[model samples]
Target: MQAAHELSQVQLLSVSIVALGFLYVSWTVTRNLLFSPLRRFPGPKIAALTRWWDIYHTVKCDKFKVIHELHRKHGPVVRVGPNHLSFSSPETFRQVYVKGCATFLKDRDFYANIQPGLGPKYSGLFNYTNHQQSIDERKLLQAKLSPSALRQYELRFLPILDTLVAIMKDKAELDLFAYFKFLMLDAIGDLAFNQSFHQLESGEEHQYVIDFNNAFTLIGLSLKDAYYGLQRVFKYAQTRVDAFLSEEKPKPGTLMEAYLENGKPKPPYTPWYIALSGHGFIVAGSESTSITLTYVVWLLIKHLDIQRRLRLELKNVPPDATGAHLASLPLLDAVIKETLRIYPPAPSAMPRVVPSRGAEMEGINYPPNVRFQLLHRILNFRLR
Candidate 1:
């Protein structure tokens, strides 16, 4: 009798726990579906109910396209998450990102998620949310990136560009993507460390380049892989820093030089920091520059008249022309701008949180503490 009573008690306890779980889920579903503050916005119900819907699309790499279509079907505002809404108007973008930029904060979960390790301290400036900190960090890099400095850097690129030309002459058809990537990586490696990655000469990606791509993955199997990848990148960067430090004569005009005072590192310019930033240049510059150049090449090829006109303008360039001189050309400048206007670096929504006391856009009152998100496709949503 005692044994039977104990068994009955165990079954009853399990039933109680399950019943409680089902009740909580029911309440959550009710609140999310009908009682949430953002319930007024139109979107697929599944999106407003759970973050999994958004995650699924993100993993599939079509969240932007899906959100664009959502706008087409549902009009301006879309409840993309239980707490997030995607705005499709350029007016909304300007109001939030331009005019109200200060009012909103970078969503740390999204921006900082890509960083290598756990920390309250930020190793990368790209994820910095504090405005003054951002400005101060830019000051460190400002001098090296100025126009005159850039002109000097342009001279360094000549040999690399020549090598690319030599390689292209032999091939009937070439992969511009791979070639441009190699060229840009070498160029940036030159600019950053006063050493080209020699990717253009080798005609293959360096180990550092491969590791960086692997490290920045936002998902799990990728995250586990990221550790090994980042370790290799840091090792590569440390090797360069070690070489620079070991030099009897410290090389002037190198990016690493700015961080050193009397051959010793400045605060936050420790060996580790320098190495991290050394790779960061490759991260920021190589991929985007290649993408932009590839787009420029494809578009110019597609439009022969524009290509001829651009070629005619280029032919007039004087020998030893600087980057500033190239910018002086009207059509080339316009082409660069128009290309960015079409395929921007961040093609879609960069999530930002609306400030306390709430915010308003497109005549809708967004309750405070919710994320004020924008759709990635602004060209189609541009306000006429």
Candidate 2:
């Protein structure tokens, strides 16, 4: 009789487990397919049901292309995830980001997930979710990046540009992309830290640069299961950053010195904040500028007519021309505009959250907590 009772108990436990699994599936299907607010938006059925669809594309480094295809199929608005909608139109982009129709706040959870182990302490101006906080942080470094300030930094830039030109002339076959990256890295290191990585001069990658590149690769691979691995990579980066900070002293007129003079006594710009900001300056500035310059150079190389016209335009300027002087060149301006339109450095979505009061775009009202992203690459493609 006792043996029979044990068998019955086992059967009951199995039935209960199966029932729970069935209920979960049913709820998920109903919520994602029928009950969720995003159901009305058109997208792939699998994406609506699971975040794994998005994660899969992200790991493949094709998330932007996947989103572009979705927009092409689904019109201006497409539901890329169960709760995430991507907008392709400029008007909607302005509404979401510029006009602040939606929340001005960034989606912290998303940004945090992008760099898993760093947490809020490392949230620099780009990733800061709080509006006031981001504004405050931007104020700290805005002067350093302004037009006049950039002109002063250009004095530092010309030498690096000359070095690059010399290196290119010496080598018949060279990787322009890698050289541009090295040039940008050295420029940022000198301008921000008052120290140059000498990547271009050394003709080899710097340790910090290699670490940052590895950290970024790890960040891209950071999905649900890879969180611990991402954390390990970030910890390595953090150690490098700490060592850099300990060894370097702030120099006059540079970003580090400016921060020390103006931001150290402040509330948000703590020691970690300063370190993170410095890290951001190197990574964001070098990577984006290098990508943009690489694209511009490639486009110029492919179109000989445009290159000839650009050369003629540049020939008219003084040999020691300043940025302000170059700004007057119409053809040069047009080339840059066209290049940026064709190949934006930041082609992926810039995610923003809908406010508690909600927001409307293109006559459709969205509920709060809706993750809205502008498909930047699609917009650029449309422009082309």
Candidate 3:
């Protein structure tokens, strides 16, 4: 009986010691997190307190809208994270994007989540380390996208546009966005790969393009507000998204296949480079064109007078005139400019890292290892 009682006593003491040790560790961790170097910067306490707080809001809110509101409330320099600032000033644009002379490196922790096994090869949008390499790759591809190329390709694209108008004219009311997406996709394929998707004629989304768009948007939203500490969780989510995207099969005669066959910089391209560059083109080209078309349609709906003016301008063009000549139409140019100003596709801020030894921005000293974001659209719009 005495032995049993003594054993129970020892067990209780051991349990108490273990509990106390855990409590000590938890308290220390909490203290370190709350009182870190970033504690002095102002932001939502929850974001600073826990990465999950930022992630929740980023994933839930219309990211662009929320960031705008935050900028308004917090002023040009808002501490978005423990070591981050969102700058909404002209100085920021020049300093970060131009004058700072630093490459706009991808936020790796954030991008890694979006860029799952996109294979070991790094795409331009997600690879900061390979900036020069990607730039070189981009230059090789640029000949195909040059102004001269666009002019030469205009004949091919014009027929597609005419086909679009013919189709749209028959409908009493159409999902203009969907139709525009088709036109853009088909046009891009023809221009870039010398083939047509005929997606509009078929009346269905290209599964590969659809998958790429879905994956990109999901990855963007998922990482928009994640703090560094919660990266593992975000990466896990990204891996699943990327896997789904990579499974998509490429269409024959598509730009992807062209890259595979014709090769970039040679007849037999590096598969990884081809994959990255091809995916990069599709992702960027499709989204921007779609957004531009959507915005124009929305603007036309809002301002019928403007739309009428545009029609008058387009109608005045000679029937035999090239699309290149149509670029001279002042109203068409104005409408495009207005639409771009109103809703820039990549209105999101460009993030830059401070110098390793710290740097001065507009006479203010920002310590090293800190991040500064240049809200390009906001700053430019505000200047106007």
Q: Which model scores highest in TM-score?
A: 1
- Give model 3's clash tally: 0
Total clashes for model 2: 0
In candidate 1, stretches whose alpha carbon ends up further than 4 angstroms from where it belongs are 1-17, 118-122, 216-223, 380-384
Better of 1 and 2 by TM-score: 1
Task: Sort all candidates by lDDT, best to worst.
Answer: 1, 2, 3
Off by over 4 Å in 2: 1-15, 114-116, 218-250, 262-268
Candidate 3 residue 316 Cα shift, in angstroms, is 2.3
Model 3, global lDDT? 0.62
Per residue, candidate 1 scores C-alpha lDDT tens digits across 201-295 of 88788888888776766655565587788778778888888888888895467777767888878886688777767777777788888888889
Across 1-384, the per-residue lDDT of candidate 3 in tens digits comes to: 999999999999999999999998677557535666655555675555555654666667565555567777777766666666777777666766676544444455655544444344443444444456556656655755666766766767788989888888887888877888889878875554445668888878875555544554535545433333133323432342333235445332333443443332244454444445444454557767788889988999899999888888888788888667878888888888888888887765545677677777676677777766654456646532
- In model 3, what is the error at residue 177, expressed in angstroms? 0.8
Ranking by TM-score: 1, 2, 3
| lDDT-best of 1 and 2 | 1
Query: What RMSD does each model have against the real structure?
Result: 2.8, 3.5, 7.4
Inter-residue clash pairs, candidate 3: none
Better of 2 and 3 by lDDT: 2
